[model samples]
Target: MSTVIELAPGVRAGFTGRDGGVSREPYATLNLGGHVGDDPEAVAENRRRAARGFGLDPRDVVWMNQVHGADAVTVTGSGPAGDVDAVVTTVPGLALAVLVADCLPVLVADAEAGVVGAAHSGRPGMAAGVVASLVAEMERHGARPERCAALLGPVVCGRCYEVPEELQEEVARSVPEARCTTDAGTPGVDIRAGVTAQLKRLGVTNVTHDARCTRESTDLFSYRRDATTGRFAGYIWKA
Candidate 1:
């Protein structure tokens, strides 16, 4: 059930599920993230397999230690993973990857600019202006927001992601059109909608979203559904 979305002609990205990795239960198969307390060997093997799906070498992926911040780093040659929320690059054969469970995985590409980006968009980061920062960072590398196309991958829906009243107020204060509460009078936060609105505000050309919810789908790993479960990845690159 890991669905892949092709945004532009030569740029492709997808969210992987737990069906293809080598981990056992708890971390159960196909877990691609290494910092999730899964076995190192098993995680490494899983990453290798997932990398191959993009016709890329496993070592070519530049992973990041996401801190739910607004910083987006640019990678040139393969080195080490940095502490950031997003990554953009024009380098060929290097995949910009983001690991997520309930957090939104955002795939972006400017086909004409030969630029591709991947971002882990959670409430804190999105509220802190991660999407806008990402667009700006890409622009620094010659990618224009009006020419950018975005794909929002699987994430927890608002109905399942209830929050506190103060948190909702804070999100609303920061993001326009953010769903601060549900119809049942429960406080909630919709990270996906916040990101969508932000993209629209930035004048992004296309924004695509999938209906799948990681917490609701048994095919994908869910952090909130199962606290100790493994992590899945969303990746994109230019070929």
Candidate 2:
């Protein structure tokens, strides 16, 4: 069975590990993203299995093009939502999914409002305010930030994500909490920390983070660690 993380009652939210599917080595077993050059059939079957983990049909899940921007679209149906990094929904049984490697996959839910959202927050998306936009979209669907709880999924931690000084400075300008140093003392951005701060600023205080770093954990996919590899998913849905 696929490993699942429970977030709230009437809401299912969790990250997928890299296992239990039909893809080959690089995309190897359980690659849920179609854009990563994995066989379309393998990706489809993987998705079907993922949905089954939550007791829903594969068609019940909604995915996005994930352009690494701040667009959070409200989805009512299960299909591609175009070039957006985030998706939100109040529809029960319809899952919202975000594909990620080193980037953070954020899941949010206001169970009482029957709304949930998922976002792909990479360096660019974080700078573009993806998490904040997601919160706003959730609110638009009647989800109050103070009542909403967020899950910051596994990602490349600051200690492993080395970047140039200028890029770090640029992102940190808008998200100060993102500024950090790598293990080798090089500049880096702690995206999960920054996202957590942003969520709190938006009034989403009930936040939980999966502290495991994708780059450091073989259980998760990491683009920085394996450039030609698969992408895992973070999914959220209301019961």
lDDT of 1 by residue, 1-239 (tens): 24446688788777788887789989989887777788999998888988886567888988999988989888886645588998888998788888889999998999899898888898898889988888888988899888999999888888788888888889889895676565567998888889999999998959998778888898888888999988888888887
Off by over 4 Å in 1: 1-4
Q: After superposition, how far is residue 87 of candidate 2 from its true place, in Å?
A: 0.9
**Per-residue lDDT for 1-239 in model 2, tens only?**
33566687788777788888889989888888898889998999998987887677888889899898998889889888889998888888898888999999999999888889999999999999999899999999899999988899899999999999999999999999999999999999999989999999999999998899999999888889989999998888887
For residue 104, model 2's alpha carbon misses the true position, in angstroms, by 0.4
* Candidate with best lDDT: 2
In order, what lDDT does every prediction score? Answer: 0.85, 0.89
What TM-score would every model get versus the actual structure? 0.95, 0.97
